[model samples]
Target: MASLAALLREAGHQVSGSDEGVYPPMSHFLADRGIPVQQGYHPRNLDPVPDLVVIGNALSRGNPEIEWVLNRRIPYTSFPEALKRFFLRGKVPVVVAGTHGKTTTTSMLSWGMEVAGLRPDFLIGGIAENFRSSYGKGGGDHFVVEGDEYDSAFFDKGPKFLHYLPYLAVIGNLEYDHADIYPDLESIKLQFRRLVHLIPTEGFLAVGGESPAALEACAGSLCARETFGLDPGCDWNADGIEMTEGRTCFDVTYRGKAFGRFRMQVVGHYNIRNALAATAVLHRLGVSARDIGRGLESFAGVRRRLQLRAEVGGIRIYEDFAHHPTAVSGTLETVRAAFRPERVWAVYEPRSATSRRNVFQLEIADALAKADCVAIPALFRPDKVPEGERLDLDRLVADLGRRGVAAWNLETVDAIIEKVVAEARPGDLVVLLSNGGFGGIYDKLPAALAGRTETTPGG
Candidate 1:
């Protein structure tokens, strides 16, 4: 929604928005663009009514601003439709859609095209380091977007990708997510099926070879289908992957032919798969292998996806937006491989619509067990989820204990920081995982650990 403000502002529309709470880096992003933001939603905020309201999926009819818009019969549209109507109609959209890797893959594709001189416009979920912004209004015909499977808005409970009109789409990996909206895995697959069928015959689909569900969703599509993953059988395969000294190196092969040797600053298996997805699409678009390698090698990852915050007293505190079980596992795998020999701590906040529920309770425990020690602050908005359906903190802790993994349900952010910082030793990798800010632990933890004055902050 903040990105929408940027694109709207770029299009020369006077725009201001209201949110219950807005924080950096998006809040900072808005301020930087001179987009005024009202901190709370009220009918007054809608005064001097705008031409149109881009209601995000997060806001419902009950929201004061939404109520005002409805009562006044003011024009309003979902974010996806707004993009299609204003920006995506004439452009070639390379929509990166999946349960995971959307943001990073979209960022990668955007940067690859930019380096290849495509000058493609892009709107990523997070800040793309290369672009220094989540959105761009480039002169080229291509418009790269992170096609979220999440709904467009309360009024339109359809997938956002449906509006993207994907000329080329990449389904990196698909799994059941957004449990609040989706009843089951097949229900989610049905949406992807719709996406695959929407692509033109001349267009293409880059899917994850290892994900049977993703493959199943793309079955018999009109567009050309290509598979990419660590699996050797994939259409686009990464072989002999090695992560050492802060960089990952691998060899890429496209359908049994050696494509090129590539290296990246990104770590972990899923990220390698993400890079492959972007590479496949870029190659099809005429980007040279050398250029792809150059683009990826210099690609800095998106914010909050393995962002190392500070190194204090030899304890490296990292932050990530990993609220799902699979994403949590992928992030832990990345850190374990990249910073080998360092004891890992996985701090998770079951905050997402899915993670807050019991649908993946056991799976979440299994993923967190990968870490040497784990900590979880109480579920975000516990009252919103019925007690019977909410994640059981006691069960999660006990499950980890049975796995011989020390786990704690600290129940609050301050308690978590207080405990972890005191016991953390040098060379420990402490990863705080949450979709929200984790009560600003990003600064609190580092500040507490920095009492020695020898700590260094990392970007």
Candidate 2:
């Protein structure tokens, strides 16, 4: 929504909004763009009555702003609806979607196209480090977007991707997610199938072949398709993967022929899988292999995807948006392979709607076992899920113990910090994971480690 606001503002539209608990990156992004934002929602906030209200999906019938808009009969539409109507009509929509790697795949594709001199406008879920923003206003035919399977506004219950009109869609990987809206894996597959059904016959669907669910979702795609992965049989495959201190080098092949040798600052097999999907799309668009390699090298990656928040007394602190078991394992595997640190500490916050539940309990425990030690705080938004559905922290700790991983289920931010700080050594790597803000622990933990009040995170 923040990225859309920026894009709308850049297009000379007057935009303002009211949302509570706005956090950094977005809060800072809005302020940086000079977008006025009311702290909280109230009827008075809409007293002047704007020309139109783009009601967010998070706001429903009970929201004060929604109530005011309905009571006054003010014009209103969902964000995706407005986006499709205003911006996507005459453009080639390149949507990257799935349960994981949407942000990275979108960012990678966006950056690669930009480097090839196709400045396609893009909107990613997180800030792409190469662009320094989650959005862009490039003068190109493509309108790249992160295709979210999550529902649109309350008025529109369909997935947001359905409204985007995808000319070229990339399904990085699909799995059960957004448990609040989706009842099971089949529900999500239904949405993806719907997305694929809209694609024109001339368009393409680039899918991750390694994930059986992703392959299953795209099974009925009517458009041209390419399977990308590290496996040799994939239409787009990467092999000879090598990881160094600051780079991951791999050889790409297309249908058994050498496509290119690519090197990137991104590491781990999962991220390499993300690269494969993006590379296939670029190739389909006629981007030269040389240009794609250069783009991969230049792409700095998205913020909070194993981003180094701070380093205090030689102990490195990294932040990642890895809440799912697959994502957690990928992140830990990346850090272990790339850094070779003394001991790694995995700090987690079961914050996402799905992660806070018991859906992936055993999977999450196995993923966290990759770390030498683990620390997790009380689940965020635990009240939203029924008591029977909440994640079993006690069982998780015991499971990690059985796997030889020292685990702690701390109750507060201070306790988590104290436990890690007391044991961390100079060469160790500590990664904090969450989809939402982990109660400002990123700042607090760094300051506590430095014995100071403020410490800015960079690189």
Candidate 3:
């Protein structure tokens, strides 16, 4: 939403917002852009009455600002609708949609287009390190957007991506997610299928071949369809992969012929798949393979997606926004493969609406079991979920133990920090996973670790 605000401000709109909690880098970004943000929602915040109020999905009917808008009958629209009306109209919208890798893939495609001298506009969900911001305005015809499958707003029950009239739709991969809104995988697939049906006949639909659900969603598409993945069967496939020194090198094949050799700074097979999807999109846009390779090589990645936060006492602490089972497993696998011979500690906080429920209890346990040791802090806002629906941390710990993995259910961020500081040794890698801020553990854990080292035996 901050990115959208930034874009709107750039387009010369008087925009201000109110939220319960606001923090950096979004808070800082907004401030840098000279946009004032009210600390909390209140009816008075709308006293001046803006032309149009943009409502985020997080806001409900009861929110004071929302109530004011409704009572006054003031014009209001969801974020997706605002984007379509204000920015995406008459442009070649390249909507990157999927359960995972949407932000990264969107960032890559946007950056790739920029490097190819296309100067395309883009609005990404996460902060792209290369751009140092989540949005951009370019003169090119294309506009890259991170198309979310989550519902747009309380009034708009349809998925947000449906509002983006995509000229080129890229489905990275599909899985059951957003348990609060989606009842099952089929329900989520139905949304993706709707997105596929939105593409024009001249447009293209690129999907990950590995996911049966993604391919199934693309069935009966009128547009040109392409599949990209690590599998040889994919129309665009990556092979001869190698990960070394935090970089991945691989060869790409297009339609059974060698396209080119590519290298990306990102690690993980999932990221490789993301890169392949982006590459396929760029290729479809008439970008040269040479420019695509250069763009992939120069890409700096998105913040919080396997970002290295701190290195204390020779122990590296990384932060990632991986709440889903697939993302958790894929991130751990990447860390294990990239930093072999080092213990990988998976510290997870089940904070997302889906993660707080028991929908992925077994799957999360299985993913965490891949780590040498797993630490699970108490679910954030556990009271929001019914007792019977909440994830059972005790059972998850026991499951990990049964798999011969050391596991602990620490109730607070402080407890998890203490355990990690004491247990982590030199050369260990601690990957903290959470979709939201885990009680600011990234800032607190590093400080605790640094203080612990000061009084340790080495001192």
lDDT of each: 0.89, 0.90, 0.92
Local accuracy of candidate 1 as per-residue lDDT tens digits, 1-459: 888778888899898988877877668888988898989888899889889988988888688888889989999999999999989999999999998999999999999999999999899999887787888877898999999888889989999999999999999988999888899999999999999989999998999999999999999798888999999999999988889746999999999999999999878888889999999999999999999999999999898888889887778989999888999998888888888746899988888888999999899998999999998898898898988999999999999999999889899888888778767788889998998867888899899888644444541
Best-fitting candidate, scored by lDDT: 3
lDDT of 1 at 213: 97
Please give, for residues 121-226, the per-residue lDDT of candidate 2 as tens digits.
8889998999988889897999999999988999999999999999999998888888889999999998999999999999999998988988988999889999
Model 3 lDDT tens row, 93-148: 99999999999999999999999999999999898999988899987899999999
Q: Per-residue error at 262 for model 2, in Å?
A: 0.6
Lowest summed-lDDT stretch of 10 residues in model 3? 333-342
Candidate 2 vs candidate 3: the lDDT winner is 3
TM-scores, in order shown? Answer: 0.96, 0.96, 0.98
**Number of the top TM-score candidate:** 3
Clashing pairs in 3: none
RMSD of candidate 1 to the truth, in angstroms, is 2.6
Model 3 TM-score is 0.98
